[model samples]
Target: MIHAGVYYTPGSLKARFCLAGNQATKTFCDQNNICYDTCGKMLVATSELEMTRMRALWERTAANGLEREWLSAAELREREPNIIGLGGIFVPSSGIVRYRDIATAMANRFQAKGGEIIYHADVSALTEHAAGVIIRTSRGQEIETATLIGCAGLMADRLVKMLGVDPGFIICPFRGEYFRLAPEHNRIVNHLIYPIPDPAMPFLGVHLTRMIDGSVTVGPNAVLALKREGYRKRDISFADTLEILRSPGIRRVLQNHLLSGLNEMKNSLCKSGYLRRVQKYCPSLTANDLQPWPAGVRAQAVSPDGKLIDDFLFVATPRSIHTCNAPSPAATSAIPIGAHIVSKVQALRESQINPGRTLRAARSVDVLHAAFTR
Candidate 1:
């Protein structure tokens, strides 16, 4: 889903990038002939408490300079009869597209520009020197590069550690489980329906979404996963589980969010429990309406003190830059994120070449520009 930058704090990287990315993604889609839906989004409030939160969210959207409209309960019903709510905030710029299509298009473009993507090259080690960095893969292949940008999603922290850098955080996997509504209920809603999220929590509450394929999807409840790649309940890696358990940060996280974590686990196990969460706003849905859909695991970064890193985080060495934490909206903000990384890489390269030169000075000399052009 392409976010409209409604929920992010103003002046943060998320807000800046997401807003820019919303437009960039659409432009890219247009240029690539990729189909997408600017179906919009509604944050529905089911209770007075939620309504209050909804108002705060509305103010936040304004602060973020997003295009939004306040929807009265009657207006909300008029727009989406299937959704029940006290009130809602409609964001017109929110949209949906097949991210896989975008990724594939990007890969094709990269290859067309003489870039190579080696599949199944599991990086085993990284050795950095004054000249460059040497990367060794599990398949016994070694590649040396003048600069390395590590965007390993789940293994970001590990990549930093492989470079002999202390990441100061660990990656905790959170499984977001979804269920596709029955085809018969495809017209359940006209737009993506979201709940007024709790400000304290990072995960947005389970809500209904209108997919680009003309199907409605419900869910994406965040549950702590035992394995980094664990999508199924039974999929557990002993090493992953052991590592998670051993983390002082995760233990602190469990201690703080024990009740909420247990509630998520309960909802995951009990279909009825999960149903109840969405039923508050989408009362028409029942167990029979839900069908299995593929689940996705989020790579959430947590600090040593158990604080969930809610912003885009990057760690830099003289020769490398590691994207340590970037969760939701990262995909939506991919274009700007990539540009941001490129700028960082340029600055790092310049600093290495001329120790006393600032980025502005180096850019004036066109040192990195010459290197790239060469």
Candidate 2:
């Protein structure tokens, strides 16, 4: 999904990158002959409180320089007959595409440019020195490089710790479970429908999304996962569980969000309860309309003091840089994010060449292409 820089703090990495990425991604798709849909999206408000929040969000998005249209109840109903709301906001620049396809295209392009990708090699350890970083795989293979950029999503903290850096945070896995609407109801809504989200929470409330293939998906209630990669309710990892239980940060998070977390769990276990959330705006949906769909795990970084890192976070050392936290819209903002990382790497290389003097010959530096597993 392409985000229009809404719902993020102004001047934050997320807002800046998302705004740039919205255009960059579409341009890339155009150049590569990839298919996408700028079908637009709507944030619907079901109650008076939500209406007030929606107005505030409209102002925020405007501050971010996004084009939007405020919709009254009549206008919303005219656009989506099946959706009921007190009011809504229409963002024309928001869109959707298959990110898997984009990733594959990028990998193909990288390989064509002499980049190598190694699979199934899990990195076991990392050692940083004045020269560079030494990466050791589980299979006992060692790779030496002049620079290392760790984009490890779920294992970001562990990778930092392997480099002997104090991460000051832990990754807490939250499973977002989705349900695909039955095919018969595919055209129920003309645009992506969302709810006015709680400002205090990181997770967006349950909403309906129209996929590139024309199917609508409902859900994604955020619930704590027992395993980092857990996709099913039955999947559990004792090691992951033990670590979560021992973390003071995780304990604080649980304490602060106890009620909401319990409600999410209850909905996850009870199909009827889950249906009620979407029913608030899209009442035409029933329990039977929800079909089983694949789930996704989010790697959320929580500070030692229990605050969720709501913006993009990066930590750098002399020889290495780590993307510590990249929350929602990361996929949409990938292009700009990559460009930002590359710029940082170039700056690091220049700094190493001359401590006090700026190096103008950036193109002369040879960036080594190395792969580390996991």
Candidate 3:
């Protein structure tokens, strides 16, 4: 819920989960009449060589079961007349939604089915024993679960450490700042428009996105977050800053990607630089056009060796299952992810108990019911 889109690699846990999430999102929206749009996406090629790169991306998308069509510059112009590009690859399936609403809907369905979700009850500690895992919160409240599945978002790394498992990585927060286009420019785009991403970096570059609510937003420039939940430029936490700076893994990672890191820092500091990124697709914009919105922090996992964890990392032992990293597109894939987790947990439970008639009868909704209360 807290992490963003970097915890994935092609054909990785993140990729697989995201693929499942994509389909699951469409289905959930259809079933619940939620406002969702697969308004499609386009990766604009700004140059001839970039056109080839877009082709390669098309191939990757096909492998991932994403249907896409190559669009010539003229065709791209037809779709987004306000935008200009050398050429582009049109992915008709990629779309956007209000994640906040989607989350509320999911929580509602989960609880209506007898599932209990205690929001704001953040778990601070977990102790494993012969019978189950004892979870303790900051308020000293405790709950015993036959198993503990940690999806502790921004604090995932810290939670993993609390469980005494060192994945040898630290969570480095990258804040993505966004700008909503002025109402007059809402007609600028009909689909999600993205710049061809730099393969060397995790970010896919700035683009134009049309939310389900009938507004267009631009930006989401990557910047190093001074605080984990820091949404504003002025927001900073001394303790968090100290923690990141003191982290050897973070230092090494930054050192390794010094150029890209420096560029990102520059963009964050220079409004012109950030505007230039958004202007690639929307040329009509000027400095005054950029408007601030709540920024989302990407809880990027970095290793001591300076490598970012580019795949969905699931660390499972006989005792517990920890979702080390689940970021964006995660909201889109929450249902399938939840179902997959439920299946694995059931399999583990079945290994311990006999497959009896009543247990078999309850198989459909029983474990899912247990998860609600736990």
- TM-scores for all predictions: 0.95, 0.94, 0.88
Model 3: residues with Cα > 4 Å off, grouped in runs: 1-10, 350-374
Candidate 1 per-residue lDDT, tens place, 247-320, comes to 99999998988988999999999999999999999998889999999999999999999999888888888888
Q: Name the candidate, 1 or 3, with the larger TM-score value.
A: 1
Candidate-wise lDDT, in order: 0.88, 0.87, 0.71
Q: What is the C-alpha RMSD of each candidate to the true structure, in Å?
A: 4.1, 5.1, 5.8
Give the worst 10-residue stretch by lDDT in candidate 2: 365-374
Tens digit per residue, CA lDDT, model 3, 1-374 = 11122224556555666666676677777777877777777778887777777777877777676667888889989988888898887777677777777778878987999989876777888887656788888777899988677777778778767767675677888898888877777777887888988777777777787876677777777788888887788889999999999988888877777888788789888889889877776688887877776778888878777677765555554446666666566675576567657766666576547435111101111122233211
The prediction achieving the highest lDDT against the true structure is 1
Off by over 4 Å in 2: 355-374
Residue range 180-253, candidate 2, lDDT tens digits? 99999999999889999988777998989999999999979999999988889998999999999999999899
Error of 3 at 314 (Å): 1.1
Candidate 1 regions off by >4 Å? 357-374
Kindly report which residue pairs in candidate 2 clash with one another.
Answer: none
